[model samples]
Structures are given as structure tokens and as C-alpha cells.
Target: MKRSNAKIISTTFIILLSIFCFFKSTPVKADSLTAKYSMDIELNGAKKTLAGKENVSVHNSSGADLKELVFHLYPDLYNKRETMPFSYTNTKNVPLTEEEKGDISIEKVLINGEDTKFTEDNEILKINLEKNLKKNDNVNVSIQFSLKIPKGTSRLSYFNDVYSLADWYPVLSIYDLKENRWDETKFYPIGESNYSDVSEYDINIKVPKDFVVVSTGKEKEISSTDNKKVINLTAKNARDFIIMISPYFKCISKEIDGIKVNSYYLSTDDKSLVDIAQSVLDASVNAMKFFSQQFGKYPYDEFDIVESYYEGGAMEYPELIQMPKYVTSIEIQTPSTKRYIDAKPSIIQGAIHELCHQWWYVTVGNNEYKEPFLDESFATFFTAYYFEKCEGQYSPNAVLRSLRYSFSKLAEINPKILNLPCAGSSVDKFGNDKTSYVQAIYVRAPLILEDLRKMVGQDSFLKIMQTYFKEYKFKNSSIEGFLNIIEKQAGSKIRDYIGDEIYSGEYKAENLKPTDEEINQIKHETLKEKIKASEQANGSVLGSLLLRVENGEKAIIVKPSSLTKEEEAFVNSKLKSYFGNSYNKLSIQSDNSVTENELKNSNIVLIGNPWNNKIFSLMANNIPLSINKTRVFAQSFSENSDSVSGIFSAKNPKNDQNIMLAIFWTKDVSTDFYFDTYANPESIMIESQFILSIDNKRIETGKF
Candidate 1:
């Protein structure tokens, strides 16, 4: 699932009291125990219900007498608003209407062809065995159940003509023989909480003929009539089965390296939306191809990316993923315009992030409730690797820089947050504070892997991952088990190094900081890339000038030594709004004291009358627009008025290749004509030269 930035209600008091009682359970090897499910369900769209009969065949090979069976009824979490684990305060603290509540009811349960008594409580279903079945014993359990699909946005809900079904079935819970207990972790409101052993599934669904269904496995057979359709799907060695149905879904498919990749989206007549769907399909294909080669091969032959209405970002299943429709449905508002921004970059990043889960959480399973970082942190790190190698939009260095900057800002509010342990932490450890959970698991945990990568070198780190994946495929792994693999591949000292950080979370915060030289290098590379892209598109010079300043290029704002208080205030306010905390980096030099070298080396912003500003006077001939005390002149047009104002960009005479000279001159120095017109410099085109009147009207505009 994509991490949400939304804040959650604090449960610090509850957490502190329960923190000492947390214990780790030892994993039990139950390879001999196999579960195969055959389910037949019918969906009633009007009633928002799914009535199904499930026949499960369980084979016990644990060499121990089985006394009882346990299953997780995840949908029960939504039976009442109080038990739901929504991170947002509105959902967590408020009551949900009856129509917005979801739940599952087991009407009947039969074991070995006999009616059996069962108990259900707190999302757990247990059936006491009538007889102690010896090793190699097999039992067939038949369950009749009905699910009330809620009218809201969630993993299991009906919203906007879409039904997303995840964790909606009575899944046999993983039992630890060593601990002599079932893994009965409740559904968490934030992050993932489902954990199960790999099982085979043969599912049959009957829905309205118009509804299109996308699920975890391949569609093996289909039969439909005039009003209804029944689809048969099969999945082998899958951790869980998920299904999504919508009447308006349209599918586009492509074959990548022998794997058939399908993208299911809401049908739309808009060409732009169709294009976005295609981009999502392409990104999924690219991610699958890249991860297949890097990690182990994707065992499944079919993959699906289904767009649905789910608020929790994107979710991953066995061979399928659920993407939020808003990824392509929303429009963003910028300072200059409200337009549908290109969502391809976001699609790529999000798609890759979920696709990496196939390897971390699906093929190589882990106990998410006990050790979420095992899957989430690895998926995050691998997603970075995919971007760094396949896509340049988010390189590893850039991701690290952004993470460090975000953590530093959070530290500003509470420095102790830096000491929160993440590696061995469980979902319950953080209680209801989803923000802190994300910081520790998603942000800090990945950095620990990155530190290990830097310590052991890239080659050994890759080997360690490949070995871990190969060893733990189709089984649940623990953090200590992963560290043991690391020790086997690398040295014991390397294992201890990571173990200390994981257990104590006491790494030096200074390590997160990038040195000044590294910062400069990043800025230099960014400026070069922006310049190249702008030149390729024949963009405006004004755009390139702003890009240089934003990338940390030296910039100075020159004003006349003599200025009215109003003019000074205007300059200071605009500067403060534009630069925020970084305003100190930009020097406001008086025209009298500005040096010749500064004018030549820096991206100069001359903001006064051309006659009074020395920097503007020096470059008046080289600039595209000619400004005077009462008039502004461009190459094609001239505006002569007391309120005439203009802004333009030109190559610096001394350093044409690297430096830019931009001037914002006005006839009325006290007026904020320039700032008002160029509030969002990025919206301006490159090489732009414009003249405007004080009434906020454009008199003349052209490119240099």
C-alpha cells in the first residue's frame, strides 16, 4: 500500500502502557499443512452483498495432533465504527452510518461432513475439533457465509459503482506450532495487517452480465447468460485472493517477456483519460520487467492492475494490484492555472512501489503484523532501485535527499522522534499514530537498508537480497532470519552493525545530512538537466532563469541605494514569500555596492529603475527589453506611461553560457506591478520578455 501522509489520532498513553507487554512469537514450519479453497459466490449489486459457500480442504503434516482450526474474519473490523482502524480523525472518532458499515456472517459450518459448533469473537473464528486428527489427516470444512459490503472507500467496500473485495473471506489463520497459538493479529487501520500461509484457490463468481471482474488469479473459464455471468478463477501458491468488480471497467492488455499484463480501468470517453490508462499499463509492465531481472523471476504468468475507488492509495495482492481512480481523475491547481497535470510520473512511481511488493510480500512472505518493515521497507528500497536504474525521475540520491529533508523537518517539531525504533517494531507498537508509524517504518527503515548498502558495498548487498529471496520464497521470514542471512553472506560485524541500529534505533542523525559538496553537486546536476530540457522544448528564458535560482545557483536582487519605504517593503515582502526560510541565501545588494564580478557570475535580478540600478545600467544594452524612468521598450513594441513596467531575461554578457541576467524595472517604484504579474515564474516561458501597465494589463509580450 502507498503510505498516506494524513495524520492519525494519538494513542501515546495506550502505547506506553502496552509497550512492555509486547512479545515476539516464534514461527512454526507448517509446510506439511496445505489449504485449498473452492468458493462460489454471487454478488447482489443493489443490496451490496456477496453470498458465498466456501469448501476448504486442509491437510495436516505438522507431525502434531490438530485440536482446533482458526480463521481470520477481517471484514468484522468494519462491523462497528469503534473497531475500525481508520487513521484519519474523522473516521476514527466519528460514528459510521449503518450503510457505511461492513461485516461478514458465517451462516453454517460443517466439518468432515458433520455440523460443527464454532465461536466468533474479535474477528476470529475458531472450531474445536471433535476428534484429535493424527498426522497426515485431512479435513474438509464447508462454510456458508454472507458479506455486507459497505458504502464507502476501503479495501473491502462498494463505492462509486466499484466493489473492492480484499480480506473478505474466512482465511485460515497461520498457526505457530512452537508458540502453540494462531496468528490472530487484528486488522490495523493504518498499514497492512494481513498475514497467511500460501494456499491454492479455485473461485467461482456470479455477477451481473455488465460487470467486469478482475481478481488475484487467471480466469480459467467463463460462462454467461443474458442477465448473469459466472467466472472461474484459479490461483496456485497465493498468499491471498482479492477481487474487484465494476460495470464500467475497460481493459487494455500487453505482453511483456511472456507475461500477459492487463490494465483494468473505468471506461471513459475522454482521450486524455485513456492516455493516462495506457501510461499506467506501460509503467506496470516496465516495473515487472525490471523487478523480474533484479530479484527472482515472477512465478505467475499473468498480472493485473485494476483501477478502483479505494482511499488507501494502491494495494497489492497475489498477482493483482488495486490502484485508486483518483490517480488519473483529479486535477491540480497551480498558482497560474487549474489544469490536469501530467500524472505519468506519479503513475510510474506508484505502480513500481506496489509491483515490488510481489517479491517482498507475495513470493517471499513475511508476518506483516509482527514485522511490517520486512515487506514495506524492502519494497520501498527496491522501488528506489527500480527508479534509479530504469527511470531517472527519482534517482536514489534524490530520494535520499528528500527523505532526509522530510525527517529533519519532523525532527524540528520533536527531536525525540528520531530515536523511534523501526526495524523490529510491529504495527501495534505505534498504536494509532499513523504518521509516526510511516516515519519509522517507511522513512527510517529504508535508510537503514541504504546504510547497509553503503557499508557492505552494492555487490554484497545485492547478493544478500538474492540469497534471502531464494531461501525464503513461499515462506514467512523474520527480521532475525534476514540478519542471519546477511551474516552468512557478509561478515558477522556487518550483521551486528545493522542489528544495533534495528534494535536500538540509535544511529547518528548527522549521517542523514548531505555534505555541502554533495549538495552543490546535486544542484549542478539539476540545473544542467533543467537547461537541457528547456532548450530542447524551446522554452522561455524566464523559466530557465527561475530554474537556476531554485536549483541553488548564486542569485542577487539589486535595488537602488535610494528607495522609498513603500518600495522597500514591497521588495522585502515579495522576497520573503518567494524564498521563505531560504531568503537569507539571496543577498539584497544596493546598486552602489554591487560589484562587477557579482553581476557577471550570479543570476542577477535587477528590480529598480534602469537609470538608478547600477546592475541594470551595466547590462541595459545586452538585455532584451529597454527600460527608462517613464517608458518600457521591447524589440517589437514600446509602452510609454508613468506606470509602465516590464520584465525580461537575457544571457549575461560576461558569462553567457552559465549566468542569466533578468531585470524587473518599473516607472512607479512603489508599485508591485512586477511581483503581481510574475507571481509564478515557472508558468512563464523561457526567453520571455513582457511589458505590462500598472493596471495589471499586458501591453506587449514576446520571446527574446
Candidate 2:
């Protein structure tokens, strides 16, 4: 009995020692665990076809015991024709999952040392573990799978110049925060994580020989035999992986800070085809050179560019960037029939943007699934920045001009931040809504960062940014964390903006519209009030403000002789509109002409004018008072008038940029024009300033 007790105590001590060791070695993470991975992908001819296998290693960093493993098979699994009764329910952008994900049968699933039941639920394939893993314990799930790339997915990938398939298969899902703990209640809406994702990914692929493959990670090694050649790769702690294979590839290599650029293109019919690569090479070199000078250095070797067919666009892999055929060829026989000659900027732009991903998306990783704006915005900003710095001052403007095609789309919508699922989990809900992931991210994040730059000035802003890059260089962090560092560096300016993010809540507002009722009310109110308040004794101040007409305003009488040539011409030219097609009348009422002395007797108020807000007292001798939350009107006016001031409290005034305001004025007998003055900020506030220059045609605004 004593011996048995001794053995038990010894075993318990050993287990406790192991536990202590683990706790000491684990890195600290918040609300979730940090998982590290090493994946090996190689093309093998053993199956006489391309085969893929994954040896995923995971660590349970949190308090919860992970029970199951879920894999996201994002490929266009099972496509069905548009059917009658179109229920149209696709949760993760995958509507036909059961039928599509049904084909691949998991041949084996082993947890610890035993077999388990791994099932498929639409695009989600999972293994329900036989036993729950304890805290700090690790698990490895080995999966061997083969895919028959489906037809017509808009999905594409290149296989040794012969097969270019995209969206062909369901790659493994990424568990960024919590491992497989997601709510299917809503598809990923947009921005930030609702829960957490935790899982390690290690993929192994085997393709045929005579192919140069561009993929998601740096090349580890190449092992070859007479029958086939294989390349082994290991991408650790990354969100997704892509491998492009082509046999028609011509390899051209260059070195930037020892970071290798392996550009792939088709060996063209002409000998000058060489420059295609040389151009791409130059772009790669110049982009890296410019970016490193501006931001930091490139961290990886073995970047690749290969021939593409789908829209001739480029998708960047970690070490390799893929190129389309025409994108690289130097042949430019015609305007329409062009190659690298026409695609120089895109070739460069795509290369620069993708390469920037090394820092933005890949290095300073954020919740891309949550706030993709965090990623794409930086890319967009940098894309323009690179163009301007590399080419010329105005070059990026042209590049940015193309992006502005969507500005009206942006202006029409309010930014919506919906809690989304883990990356790769919610494939359905993600799309380019005018404020979609890419656009919203591309627009707002940079806007905010640019605002930041303006706020702290360039030098301090760059200092803060440099610190950000150095701190979060290769780790995953939250956007809040970024804001925290900025707040620490720039102080309360950024803090208030960030604190207001959730405080503002989420409002999905449609574009502004001026209703008939609203417009009619403005017209009725203006006529009634002005006819009563005219200090000219001609009935009201607006009476003198008006050009001249009868009580009913059937006609407008203008004193062209009493006005200056500029004023008469302005009045005459502006009068045609109201009298041209409408029932308004004009008369030559010499007394109705506005005079400096008459202004002292009446109160003239122009709706929707900041200048009106500025000199309200000067407006026919009215007391000037300013306050917020006041309702105002905008007017359409005629030409050639002296001036007046407006009275209203602006939220944030532009101190540096001139505060310009526009208003439209229309009189009972005729429409007229006037000018006014508004306050310019004296520089000290960091907020949005609205001049409220009501675009007289269709103006509708409200209090924020």
C-alpha cells in the first residue's frame, strides 16, 4: 500500500511539472489564444495527379476545451441553376453546400490516437472529437484530400500553364479568434470579429513537374525525380494560402535587399518578350525601393508573378505575385491589342499593392474579416502614394481618379459596421456593397489615417506610424489596439474619434432627398414671413430684396436703370429662369431695388447660408445671434447684390482652408442673388466642418 501511494504521488508530480512548463512557455493573448503553425505543400505524382494533405497542429490557449475541428471548403462546391421558387438563402455565400460539399468524403480523421466521426455540413467540414482536450493540451488532425476543380466558378488558378482554376476547392477555414465558435444566425455582415477563431493550418500539395508554382509562402525546398519535380513550402501563422502553377512560365529573377523576385511570364513569339519581365522586374524593384524608403523593408524572398486569364488581374501570394499573359508581354501592336505596354501602371500598381500586403495585410495583421477597411484602405492609400512618389506628383491623382468612380456610391451611403464571422467562415455575407468590405476599408480607414496625419502633422504622424510598424510588425492585433497606440502618441484627438465609433451606433441611412412637402413648406414660409417683415414699408425687407412685382407676384418689375451694369445684367440674365417657363411675373418697380439705406430698416434671412449665419445683424439691421440645433433654409438667388452676414454655429470651422458657402435665392416676382460672410476657424479643433453650401437644386440636410 505504501508503494502504490508513492507511485501515484510521483505520477501526479510529473503531470504538474509538465503543466508548469507549458504555462511558462505560452505567449500571453487577450480574450483568445495565439496559435503557431508550419505547413508543408509539395506536388507529388504518387496518386498520378495533384494531391493535397494537411497536418494541422493546434494549441488551446484559452480556458475552453476545444471539442471539434471545422474546415471551410470555400470552393464553389455544388453549383445549381437558378431554380423556381428561388428561396435564395446562402449563409456564407454558399447556398448549394449540401450538394456541392457532399462529393468529398473524408477518408480518415484521427484525434490523439483514435478514429473519429468527421462530418460535413455544407461548406463546413468538421471532425467531432471523441474526447475534449484539456487546457494547454495540443491536438493534431491529419487530412488527405483531393479535389476535381469544378467548371466555371469565376474561380481561377494556374497549373503549369495548362490548368488555371480559381475558387476550385474549399480551402481550410481560418479560425482567427475563437476556434470554430461562430454563430450561423447571420452571415458575416462586415467589420470586426463577433466571436473568436482558433485553429492551425498546415497544407501539403503535390503537382507535376515542368511547372513553376507561385504560392502563399516562401519556397523551402525543391525535390525532383525523373518522373516529376516537387517543391515544398511552409507558411506559418498566415490567414490563407494560394499556389499558382504554370509550365509555359519563363522565369526571370532579381534581388532587392536580397529579397528575391521570381517573375513568371510566357516565353513569347518575339525576342523582345524579355522586356516584359524586365518591366515587371523594374516595377518590383522600384516599388520595394519606394515603399521601404517610406514605410519599411521587404521581409520575404521568392515573390512570383505568373500568367493569368481571369480578367487579367493580379493576386499577390506572400513570396510570389501572379501576372496575366498580356500583362507581361511587351507586344503592343494596337490600342486594343496591347500587352505590358498598356499595362505598365497596373503591372506596377498591382505589384506595389500586393507587395504592400507584406506589411499591411500579412505583417501588421488586423481582423481583416472584421475590419477589412484596415487592410484595403492602407493598400489604396499606399497604391496612390507609390504612384505619385515613383512616377510624378500628379500620377497618383490619375490613379485615384479611377477609384473615385465609386465616390458617389460612397456619398450615398452611411458606413455600416456589422459584426461579422471569422475570416473564411462567412463566405456568403461578404460582397462589395457600395460600402462593401474592400471599398469601405479602402475609403474610410485611409480617410481616418489621413485625418490622423492632418491632426498630428506629418512628422509626429510618421513617428507614431513607425512605432506602430515596429511594434505590431508580424503579429495579429485589433484596430482598437492601433487606435490606443495612436492615442498614446497623438493624445485625445484620436481617442475621441475612436470612442465615438460604437457610441455613434449604427444607422443605415439612404441617400438624402428633398420631398415635395419640404420644398413647398419652405416656399410658403418664406413668402408669408418676408411679406410681413419688410422694413422697406413696401410690405417687407424681402420686398426690397425682391426685384419688383404686384402683390400676387404674377409679374416681376425690375429697375435695370437703378442697378449697375453688372447688377442689371446679373438680374436680367437670372430673371429668365423664373419667368421663362413659370407663372412668376416681372415689373419695373423702381422703388423695389435694394439700397444700402433700406437694408437698415429690414431683417433679411437667407436659408442655408453660412455667410448668412455670419452677418445676420448686418442683414437689414437684425441682431446677430448664433446657436446650434437651429433650423435654416437655403435659397436660389439672382445676380449682382451687395452683401449680408449669416448667423449659425458651425460644428467645426475650417481654419486653413477658406470657408466657402453657396445659397440660392428666389423672390416673389423674381429670383435674385446675394453674398454673405461666415466665420473661419482659428485652428485648434479636430472635427468635420460643414459649410452647408446647400446645392440649391436639391438640398436636404438634418442635425447630426
Q: Write the per-residue lDDT of candidate 2 for residues 1-704, one digit (tens) a residue.
A: 00000011133643453333223332323223344333333332222123334444556654567676666643323333221011113244444433222233444545543557887665467788777856677775555444443222122322223344332333434343355463322113233222223223333444555555556665543576554455665565444556665556677887887777777667667554566677778787778777776667765555666655533245544455555545432343443322223345456667677777667766677655555555666677677666755655324232333233233245555333323221122223445242344444554334455455556787887777677777777666666777777888878767676445422323111122224564444343334333332221221121222322323332323232334455455445544422232324433334335443332332222232222233322232321223222333333322222222222212112221111111222221122222111111111011111122222223222111
Count of backbone clashes for each model?
7, 76
lDDT (0-100) at residue 71 of candidate 1? Answer: 91
lDDT for predicted candidate 2 compared with the true structure: 0.44
How high is the CA lDDT of each candidate model?
0.73, 0.44
Q: Give the TM-score of candidate 2.
A: 0.55
Tens digit of per-residue lDDT, candidate 1, span 478-517: 8998999999999899999888888766554457666676
TM-scores vs. true structure, each candidate: 0.75, 0.55
Off by over 4 Å in 1: 1-33, 85-90, 327-342, 392-398, 408-414, 521-541, 545-629, 632-646, 649-704
